[model samples]
Target: MLIPYGTYNDDIRADIRAFGELLDKQAEAEAWIKQFDEKAASAREKIKTAVKDGETVGIYELRSQEFYVLGDNWGRGGQVIYNALKLTPPPAVKEVVDANTPPKLISQEVLPQFAADHMFVTTYETKQEDKDKFFGNAVYKNLPAVKNNHIYEMTFEQMYYYDPLAIEGQLDLVVEQLLAHQAK
Candidate 1:
């Protein structure tokens, strides 16, 4: 869905390939891309100040409350947000991921002591009932994040993306919650 910049600013080519007019306004296209970079840089600096350095935030993300904990190696939207915030998952949760370097199957049981200050849940539209039941369970009700009421519910469409727009939107929520968590 995106072009790597490694091959002579390939996204420029990708845009021009998809929208032929950009070929005639290559400089303008580059400038537009630069705008995104500047905005992103500004957001990063803001997050840095708000979140504080060396804040190894405890984050838990899953499509369902079925106990899988995704990691930075997943390349999913949660991973992208985690990378942007420069946050790392706590060791208590890290040891639960599938035992592989840059693991692909990042599913494991959620410990009752699931060590995270915040939880972001994105699930299927039809599975809301199932989600209610799963989270209603005693095991999940006892999780640290859950007990703290740090659970944040979001939709699949709002997340599950990797583009700049999606990243910015996700950060708006995830970072705000991070800041809120810090305040508590």
Candidate 2:
């Protein structure tokens, strides 16, 4: 999904809640819900505008096939595309295979099955190394996304967890990258 670059606090909070539920961590989920609600209450108007602006956003859950929300830097430009779409109206949430389903080792054959229209954010020691590792292999070449050059790379530090605002800031950069790719 494509979304504009912006903060989707509500969506983020929901994800936190869903994450807690996925792990059966009710306490953590409740805490996240409370925090998110407080934040939303304080900025309802801003969020409403974000939803209407048609920003590109993408949402996905960890170890799940479903995409959740498109704001913040948890993923790549897909999040931005998702955020833009959120402004207009929310989309139906779909369930993807999660860790609860089963554990399948990720490999070259498995990789193509996960290829998406937009690439998810990932990192390596360096840009060239990342390309060599992911793009340099024959198995990876079979993936449609790989062939289309839809993958993105970032530093591990950028992908690490942080406060909501910090995450949003990083997402802005991700949006910029997405726009750049579109221009190219």
TM-score of 2: 0.45
Candidates' TM-scores?
A: 0.58, 0.45
* Per-residue lDDT of model 1, residues 1-184, tens digit only: 4545322212222443344353576676566556655655666776665444543344344444344455543323444345555555656545543232232223244454445655665554446676677667776777766676666666667766555466567767676665665566
> Clash totals for all models, in order?
0, 34
Off by over 4 Å in 2: 1-11, 14-105, 124-133
Look at candidate 2 and tell me the lDDT of residue 136. Answer: 67
lDDT of model 2, residue 111: 49
Alpha-carbon shift of residue 75 in model 2 (angstroms): 7.5
Best by lDDT, which number? 1
| Regions of candidate 1 where Cα sits further than 4 Å from its true position | 1-65, 73-76, 92-109, 113-115, 179-184
Model 2: per-residue Cα lDDT over 129-180, one tens digit each: 5546555678756655446554455444565444444445555555555445
lDDT of 2: 0.42
The local distance difference test score of each candidate is 0.52, 0.42
